[model samples]
Target: MSKRRQPSPSHPTTHHGDPERSFEPYKKAVILGLRWSNDDLDLVKPQAALLETFRIQCGFETASLVIPSTSSEEALNAISQTILELRQKYDMDRECTCHMATLFVIHYIGHGVSETEWEFDICGTRRPDAVRIPWSSIYIGMKSDVLILIDTSYSGNFLQPCHSLQRILQNNDHHAEYLFSTGNEISDQNGPTYDKNNNFTTRLTDLLYSVSPTPVTVAQLHEALCTQANDPSTKLRYTPQYMDCYKPSIIIQHVEKNDYIWKIENTTRKAQIPTGRALISVCILGNTVHGQVKEWQASLSTMDSDVTIEGVFNLQGYSLCLLSMPISLWNSFLHPGYNS
Candidate 1:
């Protein structure tokens, strides 16, 4: 939630606070590796293994799916099914008190051809002969955090343009982060030696492994990758690009250690009013709470004397409340219960 600046050379990656303190890891991690041809399995297998190992080491149950040499239709079907399965898994995990946040990582390495729409060359045939699939064909319904890494040529085209306002406010529940190998340019998938060993995948996995013990968030990884790409000594050919909305930028942990940590932090640290105002969105079902606006305002005002509800308006199911506050009371609202 800090203001953006140029990527810091010194702060390539961030560290986890209090190593002695144990915290809940991601509820589950599902990795999807897709390749247009079987030949690309050489890169996919090891990349998937690295991701699985990294997630597992961070105290998460990991599942990996690597699909090779399939038709675009079949690939889309498989991806859809995987996402459906994840949605089901999340629903089941919700029954348990401990498990809440879910994370999915998708890595695609293959031929990319752009025309009317950005397409993946599933069969690796050039142009008209290619069995192409549009990047946005599959539906991603899960509200959990998604990290997608695309290593094909023109991979940056895979990311849908997001509004700057939405990127800053981050009001949406669904969160997705992206890391693309190239920005509208051809990615060096096969590398100069044609080994696929010295490209984005290798560099990414190396960063992940190196920033261990301390968890590395998507933003941190992106920053480090950008730094590496900009460094002339690294001799990187393609520039990697990442996009993320800056709400609560996801840490590796799905849940904090305990309620006591929040209590201690709140009591000890003085909340700085970063913006002096906050807009809170709450969803209420069945219009039951529509009549309780004043009561709600009264209840919130008790938390801090300077805290006052400026306005409350209902848009569809969401109630948007504008609050004038002297300090950052937003963190106080984000407890374990908010995850549900």
Candidate 2:
């Protein structure tokens, strides 16, 4: 029998130096087209095609589509099932090692009514009356990394108050998400108009096809749409006010990050500490070793550092804390010190 060597008192035992994982290539996307009138199918078809182009450009391994021409219930059910199935198949805990991200795009091209309450006729059936597709339902079952696009009138209803697209984009979670819409809370009675030769759909189709070779960010796409909307000669009435209402709603519960975790303490009030105070202790853990740990105490009002951690030592009165440590060493002290 071999005895396990104990880790040094100053150093914890663990592995480190693993490169940060990426969540891009493994993304999955689904585009749902609801209630596109027969007159607008010509418009809808191209949008669907554009989505496929995005699917390919983004390298999404799996893609699905749902369109309801007449029955809203059937369409909602199909979309819901597709979401559920995809979530289960590529969930984080699944045995498969593949990283899974998802994008859901819902486009409702039809009439919207807000007299009694917010409602839209998606494929001839009223949404709230015939088949309700709440924001919660549509976004349910989603893990950390997901993007949602809602191209419809009154799409702002899907987003909760105070949540903005900028904030969503700024989120540091590895699995960040986004949501966008084609218009604001108001509905356009005339709907989208077609051009003499290429309608709104065809133009969008052409743009998407041409832009496929060069991958563009969501902001770029929005800029393109805005430019098209602002073209004075163009008959198309798609305005930024109409298509840019959808913002990002970050569900903090689903944030994904590396092993390093952060917690804000005494955030309401600032901590007062004297200058040049010595740190009590320092600790680190991870696979890779030999990295130096650094710490600094900020001045009461200025951004200058009053104290810092350099050599190993034990001091009194001042706060003792770990700034940064190897992942392996950090995990050792995570649990109550125990023997195996």
Candidate 3:
């Protein structure tokens, strides 16, 4: 028998509205997951997860400014403008409706200013704070609804004046949502649970795959984050905060819960595609199942067992067969996969 292709696990997705509905929210989104500050600060897992989530789960066309690599001020500014401009381009390119479903997300996986005042990444010999860009400057330019996720460990004191989401949104006319990694004290957000990234992002990525399997709204995400923060099962707690959102109900796309996941690679290296082959585990009955995929596809069944799976194989390996529609329909009789 040949080696079974084992993709990564099944990630989560959210439904901003009903996926079955006529009109959907968050069709267009712009995301910037950067390690663009100091050389000592390079974030891996969170950035990778965010990129994939928005593309596969959120289902929004995305533009990633930089990952792990440092970005110049000019480049950062261009990215900010690109956010507003991308929406215009998305609507113009597609002849959808009078209004297009769009969302803007600014997710920082690395450092934010100091352990005190809030700030983003930086470069050059200038003082860290000098090169740092205030949160207000960049986010203020946002054209559409926005969600900001700060996975870095910074003091909550800097945010004292703007403690509540209601206060944060009250000052900014455009709706904004905020989620921080910790409340105050020292944060354990930097722990490595995935390959190179921290524990929080890896957990978050899995949460999207498990919590909601369709386009999700900001409120739904907040709930899931809160559960994880206070989850008894988890030793690592992350504080999730949000309020006064213009459309907390607006959709944010992500990975599906039931996907026959096929990870593009197998490596654990940061900023590189895996070994470029998907891996999925399976159990074959006999040689009879090998003659044609259809046979294995047909003989699929299930048994009750205690197992934790990143992605489930209902009828054995499933993504390849489903990739080509004719095979999918030809094997429509195949059983469905499940999550543990």
User: Which candidate has the highest lDDT of all?
Assistant: 1
Q: What is the TM-score of each candidate against the true structure?
A: 0.54, 0.43, 0.51
Candidate 1 clash total? 0
Of 1 and 2, the candidate ranking higher by TM-score: 1
**For candidate 3, lDDT tens digit of each residue in 1-340?**
2222221122121223232232233345566564453424446546777678766765545565552223445645755676557656654244322155345666665433333233333332223433454455564343455667656543333333213322332354344555445323332366432222435566667666663444444545555655555555665544444442423234444433236432222122121111111123555443323346543443331211111122323353442232111111111112223110
lDDT at 248, model 2: 21
Q: Residue by residue across 1-340, what tens digits does model 1's lDDT show?
A: 1212322222212222222132234455566666655442255655666566555444444554444335767767876787677668755233212245566666776555443322333333334444566665656666555677776544322344212221221233224666666422322474332125556777777765565545445545555666576666676665565455333334443222255231112212221111223344445553436558778667765655656767766677666666654222333233322310
Sort by lDDT, best first: what order? 1, 3, 2
Candidate with more favorable, higher lDDT: 1 or 3: 1
Candidate 3 clash total? 29
Reference-based lDDT, residue 333, model 1: 32
When 1 and 2 are scored with lDDT, the better candidate is: 1
Candidate 1 off by > 4 Å: 1-24, 37-42, 66-70, 90-99, 117-128, 155-175, 183-195, 253-340
Q: What total of clashing residue pairs does each candidate reach?
A: 0, 17, 29
Candidate 2 is scored at a TM of 0.43
- How does residue 179 of candidate 3 score in lDDT? 48
What C-alpha lDDT, on a 0 to 100 scale, does residue 322 get in candidate 2? 32
